[model samples]
Target chain A: MHSIILFAHGARDPEWARPLQRLREAVLARRPEADVRLAFLEFMTPSLPEAIDAAAAVGATDVAVVPVFLAQGGHVRRDVPAMLETACARHPALEIRLQPVLGEAQSVLDAMAEVVLAG
Target chain B: MHSIILFAHGARDPEWARPLQRLREAVLARRPEADVRLAFLEFMTPSLPEAIDAAAAVGATDVAVVPVFLAQGGHVRRDVPAMLETACARHPALEIRLQPVLGEAQSVLDAMAEVVLAG
Candidate 1:
């Protein structure tokens, strides 16, 4: 099975982190067979490298890194890649693929609209 | 002139909030004519309603609510809308439009890919 590593900008507040953790749960519920895990860029536990290593330990040769961020900004442009480079060097055999971020997706837009309209 | 209110999931750690505030600076730098303000859903200072009033006080008739969120989850689908509703009621004359969330945008995806590839 392909392993999925969901990456998010970690938040120190429990409130900020709750939604992301909920999203992780939603992802796994939809794909129970897939080996899914979460990692934070900073300010939280289970950093990307550690998550990748855990995935490798579970016999995952192909891993997909999904960034949970909004907008094309510095963290997405700089830090995440740096962390990924280290993970890749440590496990040269793993086929790592980076998925597009959750931005401008129709469902997501619809969801946003629903929220706004409700308000 | 249009007023832009950026809504972010605030973080307790100064690190997580810094990038978002930086983004606000970038947005302002690009559009100096627009009145841009930052608000948090929770865990930070300067909530959304306060930002809206500030914008109105500055003679902004058209206000855009931008969700600085990644997905179409509960906050985007529920809380934001509810907050908007209250704001709309309080400022009946204001022309408020909820902008499409920053998801799936090419630039954002590019940023995510850049980060991933760099790693």
Candidate 2:
């Protein structure tokens, strides 16, 4: 099975995860069978490694990690890769693919632009 | 004239602002006559107050500040309002309006979900 992890930089406010949860739901709404989960870098539960382990435990052969950050800052560029390297070593058999930060995507940018224009 | 400010949490990496720049360009592309600018919370030029001041100087009777953050955490809920309050005091006649964070918008969430599923 293939799993998708929506990784985000967590904040102290419990409400911060609401949109991420909604994003996960939005994805699941389209593909109900897809195994999608949320993981955080800090100030929240289920760090990247933990999410990967959970996916591995569930017999996931391939896992795609999508950083839900606005841009590829130090956390996405340096910290994420370092964590992914350790995750790879821990689960040698699991294939983990790191996708670009969501904000960098043109479609996402266009959507945001539309919202801004409408507002 | 009216102005739009795409506000974001800046990072030390200069490249962190690329996507936001693209977002500003995207907004301009749709409305060539519209005035759109970018401001950072930290670690970058054109802080919120500066952007507001620039907008006011440009004869903008009203300005819209859009937070490009993924969620309404302390930064959005507290820091942003505090900053806006000061900006409001600085230009009481500018009629500054604060829009909701981008990630919370359903259209943006759907677009992100599409990107995640495509990856």
Q: How many collisions per candidate? A: 12, 0
Q: Tens digits of per-residue lDDT for model 2 on B1-119?
A: 98999999999999999999999999999999878999999999899999999999989999999999999999889888999999899888889999999999999999999999999
Using lDDT, give the best candidate's number: 2
- For model 1, the stretches where C-alpha displacement exceeds 4 angstroms are A1-4, A9-54, A57-119
Provide the global lDDT of candidate 1 against the true structure: 0.69
**B1-119, model 1: which lDDT tens digit per residue?**
68888787775555556556655666666566768788888778688888888888889998988877764456766788888899899999998887755532334434443333333
TM-score of chain B of each: 0.91, 0.97
Q: Where does the lowest 10-residue lDDT sum fall in candidate 1 chain B? A: B110-119
Q: Could you say which candidate leads in TM-score?
A: 2
Best by DockQ: 2
Binned by DockQ into CAPRI classes (incorrect, acceptable, medium, high), candidate 1 is: incorrect
